[model samples]
Target: MAYVITSSCIGKKVGECAQVCPVDCIQEGEEMFFIDPDVCIDCGACEAVCPEAAIYPEEEVPEDEKRFIQLNRDFFHRD
Candidate 1:
């Protein structure tokens, strides 16, 4: 499963996760960073480095941030 970046990342573009991602799957959004699930290797590297603890495994995404699951997936699927 891929890791999902949630709303906790909003207004908190710390970028540490992006810096450590081996696949370069992380992309910048208007207010935060998103993990491209199609490209992500599930390495968990980003989760270790994220200062906001905004990263979670897709199945483990918090109830409050469930929408980010689709948001992250959609970001990569969009043209």
Candidate 2:
């Protein structure tokens, strides 16, 4: 699964994660950054560089913060 950026990133926009992403899947949104699951390679490069520790693998996303999984996906709606 791909990674998800949680609420910890909201209003922070610490963009180091996007800088290290090999596939350029991380993108800036109005309130935070989102990882485009369709484009992410699950390489964890972004996760390692995230200063706020806001990124997590889909399966490992904390239960309370799991909504960000869908939030991240919905940002890149393909329709």
Choose the strongest candidate by TM-score: 2
Task: Give a tens-digit lDDT track for model 2, residues 1-79.
Answer: 8999999999999899999998999999999999999999999998898889999999999999988989889999957
Count of backbone clashes, every candidate in sequence: 0, 0
For model 1, what is the error of residue 20's alpha carbon versus the real structure, in angstroms, after optimal superposition? Answer: 0.4
Clash-forming residue pairs, model 1: none
RMSD of each: 0.8, 1.0
What lDDT is obtained when candidate 2 is compared to the true structure? 0.93
lDDT of 1 by residue, 2-65 (tens): 9999998999899999999999999999998999988999999999988899999999998999
Q: All candidates' lDDT scores?
A: 0.93, 0.93
Please report how far candidate 1 places residue 25 from its true position, in Å: 0.4
Candidate 1 Cα misplacement greater than 4 A, ranges:
none
Each model's TM-score? 0.94, 0.95
Off by over 4 Å in 2: none
Please give the distance, in angstroms, between residue 30's alpha carbon in candidate 1 and its true position after superposition.
0.7
